[model samples]
Target chain A: IEYVEEAVEAVDKDKWKGIAVYVDHIDGVIHPVTYELIGKARELAKKINHPVYAIMMGHHIGSQCEELLHYEVDKVFVYDKEELDRFKMEPYTKAFEDFVENIKPTAILMGATPVGRQLAPRLAARLKTGLTADCTILDINENTDLVQIRPAFGGNIMAQILTPNHRPQMATVRYKVMDAPERKDAAQGEIIRCNIDSKELASKVSVLDIIAKEKEQFIEASEVLVVAGRGIKKEEDLAMLKELAELLGGQIACTRPVMEAGWLEAKRQVGLSGRTVRPKLIITCGVSGSVQFTAGMNNSEQIIAINKDENAPIFKAAHYCLVGDLYDIIPNLISQIKAGKTVSA
Target chain B: MNILVCIKQVPDSNKVEVDPVTGVLKRNGVESKMNPYDLYAIETALRIKEKLGGSITALTMGPNQAAGVIREAFAMGVDHGVLISDRKFGGADVLATSYTISQGIKKSGTYDLILCGKQTTDGDTAQVGPEVAEWLGIPSLSNVSKVTELKAGSMVVEMDMTHEIEIAEIEYPCLLAVDKDIFIPRLPSFVKKQETKDREIRVITLADLEDREEKHYGLNGSPTQVQRIFPPEVNNHREVWNGEGSELTGRLLSKLKELKFA
Candidate 1:
C-alpha cells in the first residue's frame, strides 16, 4: 500500500469509537506497570486527539482508577468480580475482547509483563487487531497520525509501526523504560463505573494457587551480588566462595555455565538466560565476559574480577582486576578476611 | 494472543565511543542496530502467535530516523508498526521513556502480551521492563528463558537460572522481558527495504498530547541518569604462553605454584 493510503486508512474510526486496554491486577498489590500504561494513555490521547481510557480486569482494582487519573487519563473501565479476581485466560480475554469490540479504541497499550505477555496475543486474536510488545518508546505522527517507535533485534534496531487499516493500534511497553505520570494530591479526577457482563467471568483456566518463590530474592532489587563461574570449579569449593560472599554481606551468584555444571542453584545464574543484576557491587571469579554474559552484570556500579586469564573480557568491566588462580586467591583471602581483615564496602 | 515487542536501535557497543571531557556518547556518526536480544523476544512472540493464532505489532520510540528498525520488524512478519517520535522525548531516562511508550500503547489500545529483551546493550539496565510493568500495574515476568506452554489464560514457563529451572504459570495481562534463547529471530527479508519506506510510520509529538504536563515527561521523573559514558576500562597485561600442551599445562601449574595460587 502507498504511504498516503496507509496513513489515511488508519484513522477510520467511524466504525470504532474507543479502544479499551486490558490490565491484570491482583487486590492489595497493584502492579506499577498499569500506572505506566495509564500515564502513556494520558499523553497518547492528546497526540491522536482521541479519548484514551484504561481497563482493569481484576476483582478490586476499581478503587485504583483514581491512580490512573494522576496521569490525567480520560477514563478507567473496571471489570472486577470474584471469578475475575485472579488472572485466567478464557474469561479475562473474552471480557477484554468484548469490551474492545464494543468500545473500538483507536489503540491499546499494555505492560509487556508476564500477564500481558501471556494475554496480549490471545486478546489480539479476540479483537483481530495488531498487538506490539515490549516497546521502550512511543509517539504519534502529525502527518500520518499513527503510533510510532519501538526497538527490536535486542536493541540493535528501531521499528516504526502503524495500524493504518485497523482501528486501535495495539502495543505493550516494558517496565522502568516508560514514563509514569505523577498523581496530584489536590487534583480530583472523575471516575466512571460501568456494569460488566457477568457471563464473561466463567472461563476454563483456574488459579490453583499463589505463592512466592522460596529463597529467591528479586535480584533486580538487590544492592550486592557475588558471582562465581568456572574458576570455582568444584561444588565443594563453592562453600569457600560462599564464605567469601558472606564477608561482603552479598548474595551468591554464578554464570550460565556454572549453573549448567550444577555448582550453584539455578536462581544464582546471572546472564541473558539468568537474572539481569544491577547491584552496587558485582564480583566475579573465572568468568570470561561474553556479549551474552556481559548483558547480565554490566550495569553493576563496581565490578571486581579475579581470573587467571589475563585477556578475559571481565577485566574490561572490572574496577579492580586480580590475575591469579582462584583456588589460592579465594582461600587465602577468605582466611585473611576471617582473621579480622578490615574491608571497605 | 496479540503480542507486542519493543526493541531499541542503538549504536553497536563495540563501535560506540564517549566524549571523554563530557562523559557523553558521540552519536553523530556511529553505526546502529536492533538490539540482538530483542530479536529473540519478537520471534518468540511470533512463534507463540503462529501456534496459538494471533498477530504481532512492533513499535519504537526514537527520532524520525528510528523508523528503520520498525521496517525491519515488518519484514520479520510483525503485522503492523508504530513510531513515537518527538523532540521533547529526547534524552529521556528510563522512566520518561516508559511513560511515553505506555501513552502510545494506551492510545493504540490493542494488546494482550508485551515482550522485551531483558536489557539493552548500551545502558545494560534491565529496570525498564520491570518499571513499565509497575506503571501499567500488571504481572511481569523477567529473564524468561522459555515459554513452555500457553494454555487458556495462564502461561507456564521456565526461567533459566544458573543452577535449577524455575517453572511458573503466570496469569494473563502479564509482561515478559526475555533472554535471547527464547527463540531464534527471523532473518530480515530483502524485500523489506523495497517495501519498508512505503509503509507509513506514525509519529507523535509533545504538542499532540492534551494535558501537556511537562513536570515529569523527560528528566523530571527519572531517578537514575547516565552521569557519564566511558569505554569499558581495560587493565592488566597478557603473558603469552607458547609451547606443547604438556609444557603449557606444566608451566601454568608451576606459575600457579610460584604465585602461591596452587
Candidate 2:
C-alpha cells in the first residue's frame, strides 16, 4: 500500500547505525546509571542488529574509557580535555552535538539525572531532533523508531511516543528503572580517543563550586523506607513517623510537599523532581500518592500505603493497604515494635 | 531590567476526570489552572524584581482561555501579559511549543531575564524552558533551588544536581527553570485582579511570528508523535481492614511476616 511505501522511504535504516549511551562520570567515579544504560543499549542493539557505543566526556577520563569496555558496548568514545573538568552546559552540549553530527548514531540514551536533564534538551534543540524526558520504558519499533514510554499528566496516563523523522532519537531514562549489566573480567571493545578544540569549551555559565550534600540519611542505600506526605498536616507530626521508621530500622523520606513544608531536607524528598529510590520495602504514610511522588518509589520490592482515604490512588500501587488515620496507627505500631510482643510467623 | 516569566495552563490534576468507556481524558469540564510549578517561577521573578527593581511580564501559549493564566499572573503583580494562541499551533509538542514561545518572545519587547517552571503538570517534559533558551541563544540553568546573588550583569544561583548542589554564575539575558520552594509563592491579590480586569492581553498568532511557515507552527513542526495514550494499568487487588489500632497493627505485622518482610 502507499502507507508502506511512505514508511519505507521515510527512514533510511541503512543510514542510522549504532546505539550510543552517554556515560555520566564525575570526580573520577562513574555513575551506576551508565552501566544500566549500557545494559539497556546492548539489549536494544541486539534487536535492531546495531553496535552499542558508549560515549564519555571529562578531563583525565582516558583511563576511565577502558573501564567502559568491560561492559557490552562495542566501542567507547572518550572526549578528554582540561576545560571539561567542570560540568558546564555549553561545553558538554557542544561535545555531544559535534559528535552526533559526525557519527550519526541511531539513538542516544542518558540517565535522567540532573546533568542529563539539563544537557539533553539543549543538545536535542541544537540537533533539531526530538528528546523524551524521564522515560520509564524504551523500545524499538519495526521502522527502527525509538519507542519512548513515559508517564504524563501528573502520572494519570502513560503516553507512548516516537520520533519517526529525527536522527539519533534521544531520551533520558530514569535511574534504577533498568538492570545494570554485570562486568566481565575479559570483555573486549574499541576505545577511540577524540580531540577537542579549546574554543568549543567556552561557556556562558561557569561552575563556582560543587557542594556535596551532607550524608545524613541515604535513602537510596536503605533497605526500608518510611515516607511522609502532605496529608500529615503539621511539621511536628514528623516525629511520630521518624520514630516509626526508627523502630522499623529504616530511613525516613518524604514527598515533595513535606520537604517544601520544611519538615525534611531536600535529600529526603522522593519523586520525579526529587530522588528515585528502590528500597526493599517502602511504607508511605498519609501520602495522597500523586504520580510524581509514586513514580520515584514504585519500584520498591514491597509497598505499604497508609492513608485515611481508602480511595486514595496510593492504594492502587500498594501490596498491603491500610486505610486509617496515620496518627492512630503509627503510635500503636511503634509501641508494638518496642514491646516485641508479636509472635513470629 | 525587565523580567518575563513563562506560565502554562494545565488541567487540574485532582479534577482530570477520565471517560470510563473510551478511557480518554474528559477535558471538557475539567477545571484548568496555572501549572503549579509556574507559581514557583512567578515567585522567583517577583522576588528578583522586588530586589532589582524591574517590570515583570507573564507569557503563555494556548487557546484564548489560556489568557486566564496571564490574568492570574497579573493578579500576582505582573506588569504585563502576553498570550500566543492560534489554531495553527494546536497539537504542538515541547519542541514546537518552545519554538513558538521563543518567536513570541522575540516579537515582544526585550528583557534581561526569562523564567519558567521546572516542568508542567500535563506535558511534564521539563524541556521547553531550556529549548526556548537555546532558540534565544541565552545561557539557561535548570533545577535551580536557590538564587544566591543577583548582580547588574551576572547572577549566581545554586542548582540541585541530584547528588550535589552546584553554584553557577550566568550573565544577564539568561533563563532559569527554578525548582519548587524557591520562595513561598504569594497568593494572587483580589485588589490587583479587580484593577487589571480590563487590561489587554497581547495575543499573537502564527502570522505574527517572524517565521510564518505553517509547517513549523504545530503538529507539522513537532518531531515526536503520540502513538497512543491510555490510563496507566492499576492494581486493583487490595484488602481493606478496619479494626482497633493494636489489632490492625498485628494483622499488618502478620501479613508482612507472610510476605517475608519481617
Candidate 3:
C-alpha cells in the first residue's frame, strides 16, 4: 500500500494539458509496465486533449530513451546517474525526486513488482506527495479531475481513492493486471536527460554488495525439505513421501497439516507457515490444491500435481497432473522421472 | 514505541460477484469487513505493544458505516482510533484515501511504527502504506512476514515474497506492510464487540483535520483512472476428455508426457 501511494505521490500536481507518465525505472531497457501504463494513460490523456509523456530513470538512462518514444509518448525524461546503474536506494530516489519536482506530470505509474514497491515509496516520501498502489484500474473524471477507481479491503470492496488536494497523481500498478498499449515501432517522442548532485548521494544508506541469483537457487540450497500437509494422513506417509523425494531429487515437502501432525520438521515444510519452494519442478502426489499451497508455487514455472480430484485448483496452475490415488501415484511417478531416459529401447 | 496501524474496511473478496450483463460490481448487498491482512497488521501492532510497551493507534477513512472496523480494532486493544470521514470524501481513490489517512496520522501528531496490509484484495492495489511513508517521509518495508529484530531507535524486519526474504531496518516513523503470517488477528469476541461499540469511535473529517479544501483528496486528486469495472475474465484452457477407459488414460498420459512429465 505504501508503494502504491508513492507511485501516485510522484505525480500529483500540475494540470497536465497532456498525460505525462513517469517511467519508474528501466534496466536501461523498458520494463513491460512502461507500455501497459502508457496504454492506459494515453486513453485518459486523450479524453482531456492531452498527449502522454513517459519518464525513464537510470545511469546513462539517456541511451535507452529513444526506444521509449516508440511506446507512444509525447515526451520522455531520462534521469541519468552512475549510482542508478544498479538500483541503490539513495541515488535512485534522488534521480526520481529531482525529475518529479521539475516535470510535474499527471500520474506516475509503475509495475507493483519488488523493485517498484521499494523505489516508489522512497521517491514519494522525497517528493512529499500522495501515491496509490496496486490499482486494478485508472481513468479520468473531467468534472472531478480524479484519476479514479481501485479495489480495497481484501479485493472485496471497490474504493475510489483520490488526492484532490495533491498534484501529479502517482500510482504503482501491478504487472499483468493492466493491458499493454498497441506498440508503434515508428511512433516518436521527445527525450531529456536528468541529473542530481553526487554530494546528494554521499548521505543515506550505502550498498556494500548486491547478490543477484538465478531462479533455481531455492531447491538446490535445501538438503531435505520435509514437506508434509493434509495429505500425510498417517506418520508412515512421511516415510513414503521421503522415499519418493529421495528417489527422484530434492527434499520432502508438505501442507501445514503435516507440521501440525508432528510428522516433519517445520523448516522442511513448503506451505504458508513453512518455506515457499521454487524447485525445478515439485511433484506432489497427495496434496490438495489449496490457495496456501498455490501461493508458494504459482511462480515455479513448472509443477506436477497428483490428486484424486481433477477439479483441484492446483491442477489448473500446474504444468502437469496425475489423477489417481497418492499411494499409487507417488511410487510410479518417481520411478518414471528418475529413469533419466524413457524405456524407448 | 508508538505504532500506527492503517486499516481499511473491505468487502469479502470471495463473495464479490459481477453483474452478469452490466459488468459492474454487485455492491447492492455486499458486506464489508476489516481487510484480512490488516487484521494481522493490527495484531502485529498490538503484539508489539505487548512486547515493547507502547501505544497502538488505529487509523482509517471511510463512510460513517466504517466504524464497525474501528470497533473491532478497539476490541483487539488499539490505544486509540481515528476515522477520516466526510461528505466531500466519497468516490476517493487510493491516492485520495492515502492523503486523508495520512492527514489523520499527522493530525494525531506522533507515531513510531506504521503497520498495513500487503495490499487490499478488491483493488489488489498495495499503494497506500508506502505512499503514506512517502507523504510522511519515512522508511518502509512491504510484505513483511516477521519482525526479526527491534531496538530503542531502529529495527530490522523480514519481508516475505514469492521465494525470497528481505531483512532490513526501519527507523521510527517507517511504514511496514505485513502479510497474514505477520500475526493472525485476534478473533472478535461477542462480548467485546458490544463493549467496544459503546466505546467512543473518534471520527474526523476534512474540517477537523484543517485539511486543504481545494479537494486534494476524494477522487479529485487521483490521476490514473478506472474507466470500467466488471468481473475479471476467467481464462480457462481446459481440454475436455470425451473418450473413456484406456483411450482417456492414453490421451491424458500423452498430454502429461508432452508437458515433460512422462
Candidate 4:
C-alpha cells in the first residue's frame, strides 16, 4: 500500500460554512474561555471570509445563547434539554457531533479544558476528523485551512498542525491564550433552537454528584498572583508563598507539581491542567517554567521569576528574573515592603 | 478478574530541545522513559490487583525498543507484557495508533477493565484511550481523578473537569484515562526489577493483528498534516544576577520597587 498525501483540492472545500465555537456552560453560567474562543473565532472568521457561530448545549441554556449574541457571533445553535443538564460524555459528544454533520462548519474551536479535552477527541473519532489540543495560537492560511499551533513534547517546540483534508478543522485553545471580546450592550445575533434527536441524548455513563473540590477563588480575576512549584521542598513551603501572596494583596497558585504534592488544591494550580490566569502582576517562586505553566500566565502584564538555578527556563519568560533561593529573597522583599523603603534598583 | 493497562515510551520531556536554525526538534539521541503520566495508570492497576486479585498485562504500541516501558511495568508488578511493534506502524497519528492498539487488544484477549494515562507527554493528545474504546465498542471516561466504588460488575469514579468534579459510574469492560494524583505512584521496586530482568515480553507485529491492512496502519491512515514547526516567540530581554543571597535579595527588592511592585 502506498502512502499518498491527500490533495488539499480533492475535497469539496466550499461545502463547509461558518466557523463554530462551542459555548462551555453549566448551571446557566458560561466559562469565560467560551468568550475567548469567540474572540479568536471572530479573528479567524475574518481571515477565511466566514460568519462565526456559537454552539451551546445544556438543559435550559437558551438564555445563555442569547447572551452569546453579545460576543459578536453571527449565530448561536442551542441544544437545550434535561439530558444535557449534566455533562455525560456520550450525550454531549453526540449533540455536537450531529450539529457538525448538519451545519458543516468549516472549523470548530473549543477551550482546552477537561470537558473540551474529553469531548473533542470522541467527536473527532466519530466524524473521522483531526483535532489539535491545547493550542496556544490559531490562524487561517490563504487556502482557508485552520493553522493550529501548540507547544509539543513538553513545551520544547511549537508544532503547526493542519487538517487540510478534513472538514470542520478542529482545535482546542487554552483559556487566557486569546483575549475575550467585550459583550455589547445590545445583542444582535440570531439564536436557532436546535431540535436534538432522542437517540443522540442516550448515555452509557451515569453521573452521581457534582461538587466543588475546594472553595473556589476566582484566580482569573485576581490582580496579583504568587505561584509555587517543585522548588518548594515540602508541602509546608506553600504557606510562605501563600503569606507572600496575602501580603501583596493577591492570591496563591502552584505549578502542577505543587498541586500533585497535595500542597495546594487543583483549583489553585495555574497551568494547562489547571486554571489560566492573566493578572496585573505575577511572581513565580521556585517555578521552573514549562510551556504548560507559561501558557497559562505568559499574558500577564508583568512577570517576576525567583529561582535558585540560574539556568531555569522561567527566566526566559520573566520580565524580571531573580536568581537566588526564593526562601531567602521572599522574606527580604516582604520585610522591605512593610518598612516603606524605596527598594528600587 | 483480568486487567490490561496501556503504557507508552516517550522521549524524556525535560531533554527535548529544538534547533534554533532549522526549527526542527534535535532528536539524535534523546533518552526514552515510561511516560510520566502512564506511571499513574500502572500504579492504579497494581492497586486494583492488590484488592481484586487480577492478572495484569501491560501493553504498548511502538517500536521494539518500547519494550522498555513494559519491563518497567513489570518492575512495578505487572504479570505480563506485550509490545505491538512493526515498521508499518511508524509515523502513525492518534487515530491510526488507537485503531492499531485496539486490534492488538483484540488479539491479546479480553479483560474486565482497561486503563491508560489521560494523555501522552509527547503527542499530548488525550484522544487515543477513548478512541480505542470506540474501536472496541466500549464505554470510556477521561480525567478520572478517583475511583470510589468497585462493585462486581460496575465501578464509580470521580472525574475532574477543572471547574467541578463529577462522579460517574460505568459497567465492566470499560476504559478509563486516569488523571494525576489518583494515587501517589509507587516507585518500581529494585527487587522486582531484578526478578523480572529476564521476563519475556510478548511482541505483536503487523501479522498478529486481526486487521492486517497495511494502508490502515500508519502515516497513510493519519489525517492531520504538519505544515511547519518552530519555537514559540520568547522575550529575549532578561537580566541574570549572581551575588550573595542577601545582596541578590536586596537587588530583587529594588527591582520590584523600580517596577512599582513593592
Candidate 5:
C-alpha cells in the first residue's frame, strides 16, 4: 500500500478563510441542494464576516460555473477535467483535498446525496477533521463554529454537533431541508479554474459497467404525494392508491414496511432512511406516523391523514386528520374526484 | 478467504427517550439488539465464507454489554468475536470512531475482506465504513447491492449509486458496506447458540492499540462536540374529523380545495 502523508499538516492554521459549498452536479446540471446550501452558507458567513465560495468540479462544467455566479457567491472554483467526468471517489477526494490544503476554508457544506456522503467522509478522514452527516439544520456561533443539527436515534432526538477544533468543519446537509435562494438575473461572482495534480487523479478502483435502473419518478421532486402505510392490506391494493395518486396529479410514496413488502420501489419510501420530501400536498392513508416517517415529510405544505384508528400518531403531524377506514374513504374520494364534483372555493 | 464483519448494538426500539434537562439519551432500561442493518452484513460474510471455505470474525466497538451482539453473531455462524471497549473511547464521532476501529482491526489478525452494514440505526451516518477504509488506505465501496462473484484475490460487486448501478471489481484487503436486502439474514440457530455460548470474546482497549496517544482514542480525539440534544419538536395541533365515509370524503375535498391542493 502506498502511504500518503496526512494532509492536515498542510493546512495554514492562522489564515482567514471563507465558507465553501461543494457544488454537486450531474451532466452539468446543478443539484438544487447546492443552491440551498449556498443560501445557508451565505447566512452563516455573514455573521462571521466571511465570504461564500462555490466549488465546482466536473468535465466541461464551465457553463454551470457561470450559472452559479448569479447566486451571490463571492468566488467560484472550477476543476474541469476529464478525470472528473464521472464521480470516482479517489480523483474527487484528491481534487477536494488539494482545494482544502490550498484555501483552508473554515467550513465545508455538501449535500447528503450518495456522492456527497461518500466524498465528504473520505476528505474528512484524509484531512483529520470532523464531519456531521445528514444534517437538517446549520447555524453559526460567536466563535465561528458551525452548528450542525440533525435527527439522531431514529429521529427521536435532534443532535447539535460542532467541530470546534477543526479547520474546514465539514457537514453533509440533507437535501430539501433548506430553501434554495432565488437566482438573480445579474451575475456577480468571479470564477477561477483550479489545476489538479496529475498523480492525484489516479485511482485503484475502476467501474466495469453502468446499468441504469428502471426509470421511476423521484418522490423528492414531486409536488403532491399520496402516501400508503402498513394499513394497506396487500400488493394489489397499491394499484388503488396509484389510481388516487394519478387522479390528483401526484405520485405515490410509502412507509418502510410498504416499501419492504415490494409493493413500491425503495425510492418511494419516505422516512429517515429514505428520501426526505417537502411536497406541496401530502395525503397519507392508513399510516401510523412514527417519528422516523414524520421527520421526512413534516415540512410539506399541506398534510391530510386518513386512518381508521383515531389515536394513530399520524394525526399529530397532519393538518387534517380523518378517522375512517381507507378502504371506505379512498374509493369514495376517488369517485368524487372522478365525478368532477368541484368544491366551491 | 477470511472475512471481518462489523456490527453494532442499538436500542431495540426507535422510541428511545431523551432526558429533557440533561439532553442525554435515557438508555437505562431500554433493551438493546443488533442493529437491523448489520444482519445483512453478517449474512453476506457468512455466505461468502460458506462458498469460499473460510472463517468469519465479527467486530464491534461499544460498552461491555455490547459483547451481546458479538455472541448473537456467533449464533448466526460467525467463527470469532472481537469487542473494542474502553471508557476512553467514549463519545466518539465518526472520524474518531473510524480511526479507533481501524486501529482495532490492525490489532486483530489480518483478513482478506471486511464487510459492514450501510449504516447503523442509532447514528445512521453511513460514513464509518469508507472512513475506516480510508484510514487503512484500502479501496472501499458502499451501497453494495449484490455480490456477483468471489474470487481468490478479488471480488466483483454491484454498487447502487442511486442514479445507476455500477459493477466494479475490488481487490482483496478492501472493505465493502453492504446495503440492506442484499440477502435475507437467517434466523439465529438454537443449536449454534448452545454450542458457542461460552466462546471467548476478545476485548481490545486503548492500551492495546499501537497508537498509544490518548488524544486520539476518545472524546479528546474527537473534533466534533455535541452542543445539545433535545427531542424533536412535534406539531400536535391538528383538526380531527370523524364521520361516515361519504361525509368525510366530501369534507376532505372541501379541505383540499381550501388548501388549493385539488
Candidate 6:
C-alpha cells in the first residue's frame, strides 16, 4: 500500500487561458446550477478578458450544447459517449482531465452537488491543484487569481482563499447561491465535440444497478419553507406545521435536531450541514437560531421567526420576529388562515 | 479483514470565535471532541468488524491531545490507534493534509478498507476522504448511504447521487466515506474505557514519512492559501412583536398578505 510522491514543477501561469464551468446534467436535461456557474464565470471572465467555456460530459448530450450558448458562453466542449452516460467517478474524472489538458482553463466552477463534490476532489488531486468546496462568493483579482470565500467552522467565520500558483483555480458552489444568467433568443457559442478514447473512459467500480427514488419536492427549490426547530416538543407536532406549510403552498423543513430525531428526512433539513435554501418566504417556528441554522436560510427574501426566547439569535437574521410560544402561535395562525381573513395583495 | 477509520478532534461547539486582530482561532480553553460525523465512521467500522471478525484501527492527525479521540475509539471497540502529529504539518490545507495522512496510512500498515466520515465539522469541505484515496491511487466513493453486501475481496454500496441512488461494487483496497445515520453509533463502554485508558497510541511525525521533502508536507505543499478571515455579516434590523397569541397571529396574517405570501 506504499505510495510514492511525484516531484513538483513550476508551471507558467499564462498557459491556462479560459474560465470553464462544469456543465452537470442527468439524462439530457441540464442542472440549473450549470447556468448559475456560467453566469458567475461570465462575470469573472469579463474582468480578466478570458473566454467562458462550458464542459459537458454525458451520452446523447450534443443537443444541450446550443442551449448553453444562450447563456453567453463563448464555447461548449461536449464529451458525448456511451460509456460516459452514467457518472462513474473514474470515467468522469478522466474525461475532465482530458478537457483540462487541452483547454487549460484558468479557473473551474462546479455545483456542490453529490457528483460535483466527489468528482472535484479526485480531479484536483490528480491534477495536483487546489479546490475550495461550497464557496459562497467568487471573485477574480487583478492578477487573475480566484478569490474563494466560504464559511468555515460552522458558518461562524468566513475565510477568503486563493490559489495563486495553481493553473486552474477550482471551486465548488452550492445551488441557489448565485443568479443564473438570462437566456438570449439566439445562440452565440461554438460547440466543440471532443472525441475521448474508449479506453480512457474505463472505470474500476462496476455499477450493479440504479434505483431512481421517487421524485419528492426538494427543499432547496422550494419557494416557501415552514421550518421546525429544536423547540418542537414532540414528533407528532410536525403535523400541525405541515398543515401550515401546505396552506402556504410550500413544503415543511426542519433543523438538524428535528431531522436527527427522525421526524423529517435529511433532505428537508436546512442549515450548514443540510441544504442551503433561499426561499421567497421562510417561517421559523421555535428554532433558536444558531449560526449553523441561520446561515442556510438568511438569504431568504422574507423571513418570519416565532420563538419563546426573546433574545434568540435567529432574530438578528429575521425581518419579523415574534416573541411567543410556537404551540400557541401556530394554532392561531392556522385558524386565521383557514378563516380566510387575510387578503392576498 | 483489516479496517482503518480516519477521525479528527474538533472544537466541541461551533461558536468558536476568531480573534479580530490576529486572524487566529481563539481556542484557549475550548474543549474539543471527536467530530460528530466521525462517530458514524467509527460505528460503521465497528459493525463490519463485529460481523467479519477483523481488527479496527483508528487514526487521527492533530496535536498530542488528539489522542483522546483515539481512546474514545478504543472504548468503542477499536483494536489499535495511531496519531500523526508534527508542528511542521501545521497550516496544511486539504491537499497537504490528505497527502500527509496518506503517508501515515502507508506507514501504519495496509488495510482492506479505509473508512471516513462524510466531512469534518470544522472544515466542512467533505474533500479529504476522496483526496486521500486519490493520493493513494485507489477507487473512492462518497455519499455512500447503504452497504448492500460485503464479500471477501469486494463490497457493494448504494450511493446517494442526489437525483438517483446507484448501487456499485468496489474491490478491496478502496475507500468509502460513509454518510451520517449509516448506523446509530453506540456509546463508548465505561468498562472498555477504563481498561484502554493506558493503551499506547503510536505517534508519527514528518520525519517518519518516506516523502521527507519539507516543501511537500505542510503549508508549503498546499496550493490554496487563506488570504483573510472575518466574522460573517449579520442583519439586525428586525421588527419584534410581543402580544397575545391571537393578536400576533392576526398581525402576522396581515403582514403575510401585504407580502403576497397568503
TM-score of each: 0.46, 0.79, 0.61, 0.78, 0.80, 0.80
Report, for all candidates in order, the number of backbone clashes: 134, 0, 71, 1, 0, 0
lDDT of 5 by residue, A1-345 (tens): 122222232334347489999998877988888999999999999998899999988898877789998899999998999889877788888899888888878999999987898889988999999899889888988767888998877677888998877888999997767877878989997998999877679766777898988644889867789999999998888888998888776899999999988889999999999999998789999899999999999988779999999989999999899999998788887877777645421
lDDT of 1 by residue, B1-262 (tens): 8888887787666455557686555677667778777888878888898899988878788878787788888878777787877766666656567777777766665677888886777645455665565456566666688887888777887764333455667777777888776777879777765676587766666766543665446544332233233454332433444444344445543443232222
Stretches of model 1 off by over 4 angstroms after superposition: A1-345, B191-197, B207-211, B231-233, B237-262
lDDT of 2 by residue, B173-207 (tens): 99999999889899999999999999999999988
Question: How well does candidate 6 reproduce the true complex, by DockQ?
Answer: 0.43
Q: Which residues of candidate 4, in runs, are more than 4 Å off? A: A1-9, A215-224, A227-281, A284-345, B20-22, B238-262
- Descending-DockQ candidate ranking: 6, 5, 4, 2, 3, 1
Model 4 clash pairs?
A343-B254
Judge candidate 4 against the unseen true structure and give its global Cα lDDT, from 0 to 1. 0.84
lDDT of 1 at A90: 58
Tens digits of per-residue lDDT for model 3 on A1-345? 112222333332344455656565535756677677888888887777666777666666656678777777888877666666655555666776777667666567767777687777666655545567667777777732646555543444454556555555667777556667656759587776666777775323323323333333344354323245575567876776777556444567667777677876566656566677665456665677788777775655346666667786767776656565565555554555456345432
- Give me the TM-scores of chain B across the candidates: 0.84, 0.88, 0.86, 0.88, 0.89, 0.89
lDDT by residue for model 4 over A1-345, one digit each (tens)? 344543333557789988999888778788888998999999989987899999988887766678888888899988888999877778888889879988999899998778787788778777777788889888998677888888877665788898877787888887767877867878887998888878668877898889887634778867789998888888876777787787666789989988888888888889888998988789999999999999999978778898988889999989888888888787776777767644321
lDDT of 3 at B161: 42
Q: Show the colliding residue pairs in model 6.
A: none
| Candidate 3 chain B superposition, TM-score | 0.86
**Can you give the DockQ of every candidate in the order shown?**
0.03, 0.37, 0.14, 0.38, 0.42, 0.43
lDDT of 4 by residue, B1-262 (tens): 7899999998875546677786667877888999899999999998888998979999999988899999899888999999999988887878788889999999998999999997888877787988888778788899999989888998999998765789999988899999988998899999999999999999999998889988677876676777677766755556777777788778877765555455
For candidate 4, give the lDDT of residue A286: 91
By lDDT: ranked, best first: 6, 5, 2, 4, 3, 1
